[model samples]
Target: MEMNSSNLWVFIETNEKGQAHNVGLELLNPGHSLSRAQGDEVVAIVIGQHTEAAVASAEAYGSDRIIIVEGEEYARYSTDAFAYAFHALITKYAPTSILIGATDLGRDLAPRLACRLKTGLTADCTELDFDEESGNIAWTRPAFGGNLMARILCPNHRPQIGTVRPAVFKKPEQDTSHKAEIVREEIHFSIENIRTKLIEEILDADNETIDLEGAEIIVSGGRGVGGPDGFKVIQQLADALGGTVGASRVAVDSGWISSAHQVGQTGKTVRPRIYIACGISGAIQHLAAMSSSDTIIAINTDPEAPIFKIADYGIVGDLFKVIPEFIALIDEQILTMAV
Candidate 1:
């Protein structure tokens, strides 16, 4: 590895269906800015089986160069195989910087690859910037339990690596007209050397996965919701508006809702078109994750609630009463349209 390369590689992770993850495509949005500042090409690296679909998306999502490795062993994510294959590719390319999504597979694979390459790895970054003078990446992430933001730099290391949180940046507009240089590589690892094997996969029946990040409208509750039964009221409004249900850390901690629905510094970050905060007091950690929403509507009894400060519309009333009225209004509109 010469370490003089002028390319920024974004790892485009693929699922079993060979679909490119949104986080990878989203990272490309930032990749362009970073690469521009560094005066390097933005390259997309796709490793999966039958990756034609993923490759096409990478091209449409604004990758200057696409590197793909297709093999049967990559149909399902294996930490061993992915780490080994990625290690090989990094050695061959020697890219100046690599950005990976902080997904389950990426979290498992990044540190291992960093160890093998003997480089620094930054995890769960919420912001990214390049210092042209120092030729270093300034990775900004939450520190001290989301109370403070820390900017870290790895100056001496070559091929700076970082895993950024999903939805921290929006995906760029798709341009199918643009085409990128595609490079296909054949890299394989021994199946026998893999330490783990997929025996049986069990799905959680109690929890339904929510795409809160992709939702246009989200209705979230906090400690003010009272208890588990209060979420039922939140769900009714969410259902009426065709929105997704979200929760603050307090709600999740109180066992009022599953952790899958949590939104905050420790939980999933979302940027929906409209975010409604119900009975939430707006702690800094909660506000940090959702302040970027396009339109914020808050419903709380206390006029002094911090959430009211950032809300586009703040209703100082009991959510239990305000929500039902909102739902009834939506229902009436639907009935009138049907009539």
Candidate 2:
């Protein structure tokens, strides 16, 4: 797998309906920047059936070109089929850098493709920048038990690959004026050749605790949340505000709450309209995930807590006192308005 161009490539993942996921389109901004720095093109590799809509989305979102791999075999994402399909495309084109969303499917496919290409892959990358000094991609992520940030580079590799968590970057503004080169590759892989068969997908009933990523307003608790009962306080505040509850890693690890509610570098990345932190000592990993929130309010007993630094509003007092008072005031206001 050798090539001449420094074209940056992105994997646009599509759902069952052939519509691209938000993360794939969100990654275009970073891809465009890297492409400009390298003086190359930004191309999106859209692999699925009836992916024309995804192709259009890629072009409008900033891709200079789009490669569509279409076949019945690709209708559903199978590891063997997608892996081989991506391997064929990359080996032929030899992109300078590749970005994949850190979804369940992508986590499986990215490493396999990187191994197939014999290239280094930076997983769960929070930042991506082109290093002019070394002429390589600089991938930054959390390391040392989420206590620090690490930047890695693969200068020797032809194509630098990275998996970025969903919602880590904001979506670029769409421009319908931009038209990308459409290159459709016919899939040659057969279903019989693949080992895994798609049974029916089991959809979980929508619950408040599980939809932290989609939550517009989140009231998250941290280490200060004493125990399992501590999360109940967090939940009450969330319920009062008509928002969802989120937890810090420490709280979740302590069995105070489920991992599904955790928010941070290792947990779900969220960019909600408003975020409220109660009794949480902010760690760098926690900030990395929720720093993008429009309005952040931190309520902790310690004035020196790291969470206060990024918070738009900081209340340095006992969360036990602050949250209960806060909820009562909110409820009172609602009742007053009803009258």
Which is the leading candidate under TM-score? 1
Query: In terms of lDDT, which candidate is strongest?
Result: 1
lDDT agreement with native, every candidate: 0.90, 0.88
> What is candidate 1's lDDT per residue for 187-305, written digit by digit as tens?
99777778899899876554445888788999999988999999999999999888999999999998899888989977888889999999999998898888889999999999999
Count residue pairs with overlapping backbones in model 1: 0
Ten consecutive residues with minimal summed lDDT in candidate 1?
202-211
- List TM-score per model, in order: 0.91, 0.84
* Runs with alpha carbons beyond 4 Å of true place in candidate 1: 1-4, 206-209, 330-339
Tell me which residue pairs clash in candidate 1. none
TM-score of 1: 0.91
